[model samples]
Target: MTTPIHITHVIVGLDVGGAERFLLRLIDAHRGNPQYAHRVISLTGKGTLGPQLEAQGIAVTALGMQSLRDTPRTYIRLKRALQAHRPDVLQCWMYYADLLGGLAGRRLGIKRILWGIRNSHFESGGTRLKRAVRRSCAIASRHLPWRIVCVADSALEVHARAGYDRSRMEVIHNGYDPETFTYSDTGRHRLRRELGIPPDSLVIGSLGRYSAAKDHHSFVQAADAAMRQRRGLYFMLVGRDLTRENQALARQIAATPHPERFLLLGQRSDVIDCLSAMDVFCLHSRTEGFPNALGEAMCAARPCITTDVGDARQLLGQGGRVVPAGDVPALTQAMIHMADLDATQLQAMGARARGRIADHYTMNHAVDRFESLYQTAMALPY
Candidate 1:
């Protein structure tokens, strides 16, 4: 048998975000494949997903970088690790890792270097330091990696406008494992009961980190508006810093007439179960690359309502409603429309949503594309 190619992935961190979750799925896809071997290097502190990777017997190394002050040292350590590993291909995720990993791979004369970009829009509300770093990455990206892999076409367009080399870009939408995210009546009933929700109530769910970019405020506003028009409507939000203890989220909930109906589950492990319990899924992000949560919800056979951002409309594809970003009234109207749908209509929409995912967004399809990309990159003359 031919020897497998060693592919090393470098990322900013292994946090439980969209990019991180996709990385895990990608690694899992290559688990038993004899054509490729994988290793991961986390540039920052070890995150929750690191242990999960280790549990799968995947080698994961953390640089333990504290802040920008450690950049010089971190680069040296990363370069040294690359030297020792002598990987055939270097794949970097997110901006920080893209810059550092690209430089390190070049330093070692690695022929195949790929960068993964997972955001469509860069919000103005980010810190000055973050803005500067993104600018740097954009500048460096033009000359770095052999191929820049964007998770969404919207992301590719945005990056091209921001000075990234469009010639070197490839669009690969994020994918999901249908088996893991499939619908379950038992899961729906059990989770609803566990959350103290009545079986007869309609459940609306939004999943993403509590950030300005995610526009959780808009979700709360829309939910509040929808609730005022209809009773037996409940909103369940799951993500980091989405707990009732969060002052910002708490304020939003307090403004709602039925705050008790809002269930704030902060960073759950049972996301599939939570998704199954939802009658309708919503993504109100001001920006996105390709929302993994929205796709997962669709795979779980739930009707979705999302803002028209990134590739969300492409993902929805007549399966759900899409409103303008940050437009609370439009979002509220969509929610109300969903609430007004008959059970048969709702079920039909959910079926279509699941069909969309099953047709074009399977994890296996993503893995096949990536493997082909890897082989193509390796075949190129450096």
Candidate 2:
């Protein structure tokens, strides 16, 4: 057998979140690529999905994070891992991974360095501290043979708007495969019974780590408003809290009125079933680059009512509705609209979201693009 070409992906963790899962699915899809075999390096502790990656014979390593905040040691630890693996190309996912991987790739003499930027709605301009964060890693990106890849156009635009060089950045839409995530009415019935959500109740759902950026609280606020408008409505929240920040938000959520009505299902395995339960899926994230949960909900054929952040408008196309990010009133109105929607109207709108995902977003498509990019990089003079 011919030897596989080497490409390493550095990420913060193997958590079952958007970017981590996306990388795993992409790696799984491209396993057959003769040009490069993939390795994943987790900068922090391994997440729940670590075992699955190992089971598939994918190499994964963790830095065993010692502190909550990033320090010089974090970069040094990542650099040691990079030196050992010595991959031909390095791809970093999320902010912490990007900064660390970029610095390590430069120090280790890696030929290609790619930073995946997924957050699209961060309008928090750089103060001295934020600028320091960007400046700390900007040198590695600019000086080395590096590229910044955004999963959505809005993400790419956000990077440029934040003074990142346009020429060095690219946008690639994450694809959705119906094979991995399919809509199931049968699953919906099963989940509704488990949660005691009436079959007739309008289900509004969002799935993500309880993070500030995800702005899940905004979704909760919208649900509160919707519940007032129409009593007995249901809302489901999936995914676990990973950090103190997200945990703080969850605590606040639980303390609110009718917390029981808001089902806080932490780190669920039956995502498809939960998606199935939602009649009208919503994500009121304050900012995003690409939202994996939003795509999954659409795949489940729910009428998507999302805040206009990330690549939602572009991705949703004409399939669903978009409101301004964090606008509780608008999100509330959208939720009420879903409450008012009959089965007929929902089916019509939802079919569009499902069709859009089936046609565009899929692991197969994303993997293909990545494979091609790797090939082009390998063919170039190093």
Candidate 3:
């Protein structure tokens, strides 16, 4: 019998962000498949998602790396782990992992090195160390990796212009599981009651961490404006650092006309149920790659409103609304328009949104692409 092709995934961490969540979904999709075997190595300690991966029967290793000073020690540990596994492929997620994993894999004479890029915008707001690592990755891209996988076409284009090896890059979008992210009236009402929101209120929800890139400030500003015009409107926000303890976010909510109408849910594990509770979902990020939240919400049969960032316009298509990033007026108008939409129209739009996900963005389709890519890489001459 032929041995299963072992693939080791290297990531910066296992936190509940887009790339990490997608990594879990990608690996979990392969459970019980005889064609591939997978393991994960986190440069930092196992984050929140580490135990979940272990529960799924995948092994996870954390190197406990905290700063640039740990590079030498981390490199030795990573090399030792790779030697133990002797994987056929090294799949590195994000910039840091790409550089570290690529160098380590090459040192061990591993030929099938695949680097994953998930960020579309890099000109604004990143640490100096992160910036330096990205620059280094660009220089090493020419020969270190056999292929580069980008989450969106926008990301591929952005990286290519930044001196990455354009010839080796390909785009593979993130996919959602319909079984996990589908619409549920029971979930909708349950979450509403839990948050002290009226059952009949029209909820406009957005999910993202509190950062300049997410532009929660603009989301709140627009929600505040729209709430003044519509009496039965509420906003539900879910993400890390979004609670009342976040003084800046709290102050923004307080300045709004009806602070009571804003519900802040910080870092939830029940994201699918949260998506089900929304009447309309919004993605207000100033920049993104593919936006897992918008697609997940659409999979839950919710009409969406998104800023023109990343591949959002392509993902949203005609299922919902699109406005310029950081345009408070445009976002406010879009919110008001969505609220003004009748139930039948809203339902029709939602059905279309869900249909799009089923047709083009299912987890099975994504997994098939990844498997095919792996097979192609394996067949290449070392």
Candidate 4:
């Protein structure tokens, strides 16, 4: 038997974010595969998902990084961990990890190192330190790591403009597992019942963490406008920091014309069920690389509407609607138009959406591409 390719994944942390979730899915798909063995190293403490990974019998090491002041100590710790593991490849996720992990792997003389980029645009409200780290990664990109993997084509273009080496960059969209995210009548019925949504009503839902970029305020405005013009139009929102306790979000919801019709299911475990219950799913982010929730919703066979951000238009592709980002009026019109569609039209559109995913974005497709990339990278001379 061939020796397994050992991959040590390094990340800033294991927080419940897009990049973290993507890492989990990528590694989980490799279970029982003889060609690859994987472990994780978190620069910060073991976050919410670390224990979950450990539960699956995957090794997870945390360096307990607190702040930038601890860089020297953390760098030493990361280097020691890499030396002890002696992985064949060091895969770093996000900018900070790329900078730290690339240096460590190079110092240890590891020939194969890959950097993962998860966002197309810099955060509009990011901290100065984050901007500095991103600039540093761009400079390091010229030499560190054998390849850079982007989650979307838009990400590749954006990073190229930011001075990342376009020659070494590759695009690999996020893929979904149909069995885990497909439509289910049981899930739909149960979610509607649990949320007290009327059987005859139409629900337009959005799934993402509440933040400035996600533009939850704009979503609320659009939902409010759509609700004012039509009855039986409900809005469902699911993600962290989206609860009524968030004063700003709560105020927006309360000010909506039909407040009772809005469902704020903050950060749920049964996301598939929540998605299944939606008659339409929307991705309203002002920025993204490749959105997992949008794809998962499409996998659930929900008719989707997304802002023209990241690769959403490329992903949706004749499946559903696309509107300009931050345009509340445009989004409101799209929501109203979607709600006006009959059951047959909505169902047909949803089926097409899922079919597109099955054809182009299955987890198997992504895994195959990744495996092929790894094999090719290993064969290349240093």
RMSD of 4: 1.4
* Candidate 1 residue 326 C-alpha distance from true site, Å: 0.3
Indicate the residue-level lDDT of 262 in model 1: 95
Q: Which tens-of-lDDT digit does each residue in 58-88 have in candidate 2?
A: 8888888765466577788788888877887
The candidates, ranked best first by lDDT, are: 3, 4, 1, 2
**lDDT tens per residue, model 3, 120-171:** 9765668888788899999999989999999999999999999999999999
lDDT scores for all predictions?
0.90, 0.78, 0.91, 0.90
For residue 256, model 4's alpha carbon misses the true position, in angstroms, by 1.7
> What TM-score, over all chains together, does every model reach?
0.97, 0.91, 0.98, 0.97
Best prediction by lDDT: 3
Off by over 4 Å in 4: none
Higher-TM-score candidate of 1 and 2: 1
Candidate 1 lDDT tens digits, 37-111:
889999996699999999888889999888878989999999999998888889999888998999988888986
TM-score of 3: 0.98
What is the C-alpha RMSD, rounded to one decimal, of candidate 2? 2.9
Instruction: Pick the winner on lDDT between candidates 2 and 4.
Output: 4
- Residues 1-382, candidate 4, lDDT per residue (tens digit)? 9689899999999877888888899899988888898999999988888998998889999998999999899999999999999998889999889999999999999979999999889545589998988988988998997999999999999999989999999998998898777888998999899989999999999998899989999999999889889899999999888788989989888887778888988888788888989999999999988988888988999999999999999998877999999999999999999989999999999999998899999988888888888898778786
